[model samples]
Target: MQTAGSIQAQMVGRSGVVATLALCFIIALLEGVDNQSMGVAAPFVARHFGFSPAQMGLAFSIGSLGLLPGAMLGGRLADRLGRKPVLIYSVVVFGIFSIMTAHIWDANSLIFSRFMTGLGLGAAMPNLIALVSEIVPDRLRRTAVSFMYCGIPLGGAIASAIGALSVEGGQWRHVFYVGGFAPLILVPLLIFLLPESRNFLASTVQKEGRIRPAAISTVLFGERRTVLTIALWVTFFFTLSILFFLMNWLPSLLVRQGIKPAQVGVIQVLFNVGGAVGAMGFGWLMDRTRAWMVVLCTYVGIVVALVVLSQSGALGMIYLGAALAGLFLIGAQSILYGLSAVYYPIVMRGTGSGSAVAVGRFGSFFGPFAAGELLAMGFAPPLLIGAAVPLIVIALISTLVVVKRPVVKN
Candidate 1:
């Protein structure tokens, strides 16, 4: 019998695997573009709709609300039905809704369109992570996964570029139109080119009559992994909270910090550029060293970067700080996703990653809203940015706990 591992071995170094990675990267890029589109478009959207900052914050957070359910439901469906179908369906869902966003007439309608778009975006993520994990060789796992995730920051950079263009002459709705229509166009390519996860078919469905309850249960409450799972969730939550806070509010916050309006996009692009570098570097380090150690050190870098950002005195310093922050913060999150890929068994990998992402989405929701509230309360930007320090410390502790736990392979 060809076990999942053996099947993976056969696929190592194949051109098809490279193609798979490329397509997955593009999918992630689209998700990133859509994800950051709102942040880039926020000021414009608010201006058009006469929205308060708080209302804009709500617009930012509400999409994450849809992500929560979409992730949970999508994970379960991917585990049962198959990763390919669920992934394709998610792309279609997000693409169509993103297009619909271009047509919204009011704030409520905008929020509704975004929330629906979130559902598709959320559904696609775990499956992408899980699929890459299943397909790549063990030696290349971290690197491949990290490379795939680089699309996220790259996508964000693309959004910032679009934002810059919008500032020049384009409308914000054009951003939505591009975000929506591109994914719809990609659907056909995905259907024809994307391969189903062989490990999932071989190890999950064929070997077992059906997905066992233990498969799902073991990821959360299994004896060897329970503590690790909890710690992973904590790490994901804090990191994502920080990430979303910056993603949704960084442009506006920089505007408040007296940054030149034109320079805002440059800073955003630099942030994501650093993120891509960090993702690849951390992935290389994790493959070469202890993952937990790499993760711990990365969080430390994040704390230092945040502190620097809070007290930056010059444009150069602020740009450097933003780059460092994106490097470690976003890189650390990518590490968590890679960890989840390696941590769980094939049977429930999608569920495991989805659940973690779902939890992180709550942090995503909280980060922006809390920042808005704090701003409303007249908190300083420095204080607001520095607040993440303690959360990263807590994440560091959780990672320490995870490191001490035994690896459980199902």
Candidate 2:
């Protein structure tokens, strides 16, 4: 029979894991709010500054450009220093710049502030993924990570609701204000409540000073990891291209399509709401069903949603299409993130996750910029929406290849 002390220890361990997930979820939610802030406020900001389509697109892409370096550096630093301190600093950087976004006097200032904010957000992501991955057992990896990921879309939904409320008032700056302050408020809680990953600590003791350039190359390209890394990069690139494109452009596209701002907010909310549901639902399914099945369902749903969105003119159809798109697009991203966390050993998990995210940041940067350029060149919104289908198909194929390889849990 198990001893009472052993039973007590197990309960404490379970509670600790729950607490960790809860904290990570809150941070992820804040990140999502900030991530979606530009999209929610774009129309109003455009009006405030008289930004052209190309210029607005540039602003969107500039912020994401910060993410590339931030992710690379943040992941590297987390491995060198630790996840908690790095995450704390990242939150502070993003929060301050996010508030600065509310006070920008010109387009130049706005872009700079947003870029700084994205830098902070970028840094936080890999740490969050790494931290959560370490805390959970292999059996619950997808489920745990997916649960944490759900907070992101839920946060986006909250931002969309705020946008809906502020539409008539033109209070666009309030979105940034909320996004800024909430994370700052949560900092104190994180400092006191969050625990550092035991796995990270254990790895540090076992292999001190292994974060060399040579080691990184080996982790990424050595031991037959080359193909896996390439597949991951391709999957992240194409999938995030479509996902970010929709996120940054969808609201503006709806407005241009003659949808009312209020209705557009509703559609945005549905999109994020669908995303939240999909993140959890698909994540759960991944743990139980075949990985290829999830991939097929996710990408196929994306294609169908995009087609429906492109063809739909009525408000109801638009909402349905947007929701479906959100469901699959965000769901697919969560799956990719979970896989990224699982693919590498614990020692290099931060680096692996960070590098993949940085590459995805490139996609995030290009997607909005490309969409903006095309729109400025007089491409129809429907055609642009449909264009994402080809990218999704490519990502689907790459993801299938990735899942076929067996993963060894660290």
Candidate 3:
């Protein structure tokens, strides 16, 4: 028979895992809110700042640009220092900058604030992924990560709700105020309640005993990891490009297509709500089914949704299309994140995941900027959205390669 002490320990461990997952979920939700805040608030921000399409695109892309360096640096620091402290610091950075966003007086100030917010946002994700991955068993990893990530879309739905409420009143700054303050409020709870990754702690002890972790280049590119890295990066880049494009520009496109602001908010809310459901559902499927089947279904869903979004005219149809788009697009993105977590071992997981995310940030940066330029050049909304189909196909191909390869543990 099992000893009572051992069972108690197991129970404590399970509770710890639950707590960590819950905290990570909350943070992910906050990130979703901040990320979508600008998108939902864009119309009002542009009007208040007198920003043209191209300039507004620049604003959207700049925050993503900050994500690049932030991911690289944050991932590196998490490995070197620790996940808990780095994550806390990142939350503080983003929270402060998010608050600053509401107070910006001009374009330069706005850019600066958002870039800093992006830095914090980028930094937090790798740690979140790393921490959750380390805590969960292999069988439960995907579902757990997806469960945490579902917070993002739900949080985004909250932002959309805020936008819907504030849009008529020109209370765009209120969105930022909420995004900025909530994370800060959550900080103390994180400090007291959150635990560092046991895997990271173990690795740190090994490093102290003269068994240093592998060099960064070796961790990412050595031991037959090159192909896997490239495939993962490709998947991240294209997937994120389309996802961010839809996120940042979809509302504006609907408005241009003669949709009312109130209705646009409804579509956005449905989009994120569908995303939250899809993230969890597909993640469950990925855990239970063949990855290729999930990949095929996800990409096909994305294509069909895009087509519907572009071609449909009725509000209900558009709403359905938007929801489907969010369902597959965000679902696929969450799957990629889970894959990255499992692909690398605890020693280099942060850097591996971070690098992939940083590269994806490049695509995220380009998507909105490119779309803005295209729209400025008189591209139709349908044409612009249709263009994402090829990128989705490309992402599907690369993601298949990634899932087929054996995961690297050392």
Candidate 4:
């Protein structure tokens, strides 16, 4: 006779699994659109409001501030409640706030709206990672997670395309409208079609009888998991910082580098395209090799790519460098999500993944802020790109540590 766990796993067959994956992918894609929409519309928004660069940077960072709390609350709630409810509610929250963004009149209002939107984005992510991790076959789990994550860059590319053609022509509010409305449309489908995580129901609730809420500290650092948890946080912090720095500032920076206004969109699209490819390719490699080894190599690739970008004056070299950087930097971050899923058990998976993201979101806030400060100081592109090298090196070393001392599963 099949055990409860085995039966639950089997309940969602191949087609059901595929459907779930598709839903998760769409959720992630919407998240990408919602988050990147701000960056894509930043130049236009700044001009419209007559805001200074510092004010714009603050606007960018403020959204991430909301994500910190959102991730923490959402992840724990998902653990205590069910993943489906939290996931659905998160989408609703962000969608409503995103629509409100279209009506903002000043810096403060924009910040408030984006911050509220961040909460939903933050909450939805951990559950998505945990759900995808639990449902997929063990061997394919990493690849499945990575595949879902590719939606982030794909959405970014889509946002960039829209912004280049439409928003630049003074239709910035349309970006937010699209971001807000599409997710609202998805909510109905999510309500009707999304299934509760079987593993959360079986392994978490059934095993405990009554849910004993695990503290974030106890869940992450308990069972001698401290070193691994810390390393994961460090890795997440640095990688996400770099990723967001580029995501938020790259277009403006490229324009400042004498690149034509029209060409910035193409570079952003190319960057995201490379990111999607790298994420899928590295994910495949992670399943076959030492996962840390794959991550380490990716960070090294990021360093090399940054160096080339720093020195390049030619358009081809600049484009090539951006693509390579995105491939490795964004790709490696996707793999880290998969790694976080693998590190925690079903019971604490939401908390573990969410906490890591919360920490990373803290780091993400600094990326755009620091870039703005540096730009204010008149720092050149080469110096800004060069600064990322040490962070990537730190990430590379952190991966080595994770590999050497694996976290004990709870």
Best lDDT goes to which candidate?
3
TM-score of each: 0.93, 0.95, 0.95, 0.95
TM-score between candidate 2 and the true structure: 0.95
Q: Lowest summed lDDT over 10 consecutive residues: which window, candidate 3?
A: 3-12
- State the displacement of the C-alpha of residue 376, model 1, in Å, after optimal TM-score superposition: 1.6
* TM-score, candidate number 4: 0.95
Off by over 4 Å in 3: 1-12, 205-212, 408-410
What's the CA error at residue 170 for candidate 1, in Å? 5.6
After TM-score superposition, what is the CA distance of residue 76 in candidate 3 from its true location, in Å? 1.2
Tens-digit per-residue lDDT, 59-177, candidate 3: 89988888888888888888877788999999999999999999989889988998999999999999998888878878878888899889999989999999999866988988898
Ranking by lDDT: 3, 2, 4, 1
Task: Name the Cα RMSD for model 4.
Answer: 2.2
- The parts of candidate 4 lying over 4 Å away from their true place are 1-10, 206-210, 405-410
The C-alpha local distance difference test score for the whole of candidate 1 amounts to: 0.83
Q: Relative to the unseen true structure, what is the Cα RMSD of model 1?
A: 2.5
lDDT (10s digit) by residue, model 1, range 1-410: 76664575455446657767988999988888898888888877777778888888888888877787788778878888788899999999999999998888888998899899989988998889877877876776777789899898988889888888785354888778778998999999989878777667666644354554245677677756777778888987888889999999988888888786568889889898899888878988988888777977898899989999999879999899999998998898788777777777778888888888888888888888888888888998889999989999988888777666654343
Write out the backbone clash pairs for model 3.
Answer: none
In terms of lDDT, the poorest run of 10 residues in model 1 is: 205-214
- For model 2, the local distance difference test gives 0.87
Positional deviation of residue 251's Cα in model 1 after best superposition, in angstroms: 0.4
lDDT string, candidate 2, 37-138, tens digits: 899999989988898999899889888888888888888788777788899999999999999999999889988998899899999988998888888888
Candidate-wise lDDT, in order: 0.83, 0.87, 0.88, 0.83
Tell me the number of clashing residue pairs for each predicted model: 0, 0, 0, 0
